[model samples]
Target: MNSFFDGYVNSKTTLRLFVNQYENALRDKVEKENIAADFHSFKSIVPCINHYDIEKQFQSVYTNSKFQEFQKELTRKIYYYPTFIKKEGAIEVYQVTEDMRIGDKRKDVVYDILLNEEEFEVKCSCHHYEFRGILCRHVLCLLREKRIKEVPLKYILERWKKNVKRKHNFIRCTYSGMEDTSVAKRFDMLCNTFYEVAEVGSISDESCNALVEAIDKLKILFSTNLDNSAKDLHVQEGPSCDGKSKTILSLVAVRSRGRPPTLRKENKVDRKSREKMAREKKAKKKEKENNVKGHSMEIIKHNMNDASSAAGNLASQDEIAQTVLVNSSAHYNTFQTA
Candidate 1:
């Protein structure tokens, strides 16, 4: 760290260098990712092991990595078997049992599956789709049993689609030397949209002609609107020669030439102080809790003592009344005898 700082005149320069290097690394990583995606786009897809239409559909739609995950589920579906349990209206209940082997010990794991016939929707107790966004072997086995040729469109998430355009890809990187303006971002978005449209339109002559006609109409409308906007701006300005020049004041304050105030680099002393404060706060909290608990216990003990004393006093009063009654009865007997 000292050697790196020695190369720079000030900490600010060092920080700027560090930030530039980090951005460059990020940009390189993004480029690599793009290259990989392009490679995947050109590469031939892996042949389906099961040769199922659903497998081929997934292979075409999903990225290579995600498709491999689906393929694994497809291969593993053999271990799962779905048995019809009962039917209730449009929904059918099936008990799917997976024969899984772990370290030579085999166990049967049961999962409940609900199939909606009308909607062609299926849900499994395994919750694999809910958690991983991928269908589980149990669901696949059930689908196979039901003879569903293709996976539902709802199940194929856009996040895993191979040809899906991501907004972040068009955003300018910090080290790219390009201004990250809204106009540039909008242009990139429009280009991506047009590229996708062109790809689709090229599929047939009718679509190509329709797309060209629509673009021509849009161009005419945009040109008319621009001409009207320019005329209105010209009218609003009145005359360029008659406009007065106004002076703009400079900023009152300039930013300091050092590390930014928002960025605080914690050293050993600061970290230790923070840790010490945290420990003290925790100790104080624990002490307060203990005091509260002790106070509660004291109150409970005092209440028990008060209750015991009151019971003892009642018992003494009863004994005194009994003694008085005995004495009064003896005296009455003596008088009667006299």
Candidate 2:
């Protein structure tokens, strides 16, 4: 039973904020030297990594276990090179036909390697690039076998890069303590002072203790000022002519271009009355249908009775004509005998 206006604050944005904070925390744990070894090629493209996404690789390391395992798997390829299948124009095909031990169990895992020598485009049957946006061990092995030192810029994804653009100011709509213009200005000044205090307080424990004491004294001063302001009779000045008090304009509700609606014109019927009318309408429709059905049945019965009576009358007339014919024949025979 959620209302239409329930999500005033975007849930996705809020969730993203939490995720960014988590990433930032993980980013602090990442060692820059480790990134230099693993993502050396990435450093050439971007000068400095985004502080927020500094631990992107660290997060990916735990999430993509297959990728971490693949790094170790590439060592086995050093012993054997993939079988060359065929070369068609710019593309070359290589096949890994033998069974390899992956993870726990040894299984027959066949992978076709398609390489474009001219364009440096590489594709594998395992589709590791499509799945995880990184090259599989098979392709990496091929590169190592070919003595390619650096990974191509085309293959490296921008999102996985260390120096991708970072969003600094994410604060959109934040609440201000004061509503009045003058109060808001004073509050801004107070915030500046608080920020300075916080910087000084962070130096040492003694300084922090002194800062706390000062804050308590500042609160007392603010309380006294609040009391003085409360006691003062503030006058609200507005537009005035000469020495006379200004007249405040009243807000009038504007009427549309139509005659004012009378109370009788409005549909003020209660819910019960409306429902009763609907029920009556439905009942009348059902009664009308029943009456039509009854009339049709009565007409059919009358037609059947008229047809039966007509058939009975025709049979009686036929019997009477047959008796007359038999009597006339007997009289003729008697006259002849006489």
Clashing residue pair totals per candidate (backbone < 3 A): 0, 0
Off by over 4 Å in 1: 1-13, 101-106, 176-338
Candidate 2, residues 1-338, lDDT tens digits: the string is 12221222123335645444333333322323323333443322222222323123333332233334444444455554677899999999997655779889898767899999788899999887888776776786777667666566666665553333223211111221123345445656877988997998999999999999998998898877765554232221221222321222223447888877767643557667888899999999999999999999999999999999999999999999999999999999999999
Off by over 4 Å in 2: 1-70, 98-105, 166-338
Q: After the best TM-score superposition of candidate 1, give how far the Cα of residue 169 lies from its true spot, in angstroms.
A: 2.7
Best by lDDT: 1
Q: Write one digit per residue (lDDT tens) for candidate 1, span 39-77.
A: 664365767887789999988778788888889999999
Clashes of 2: 0
Give the Å error, residue 325, model 2: 99
TM-score of 2: 0.31
Q: lDDT per model, in order?
A: 0.75, 0.58
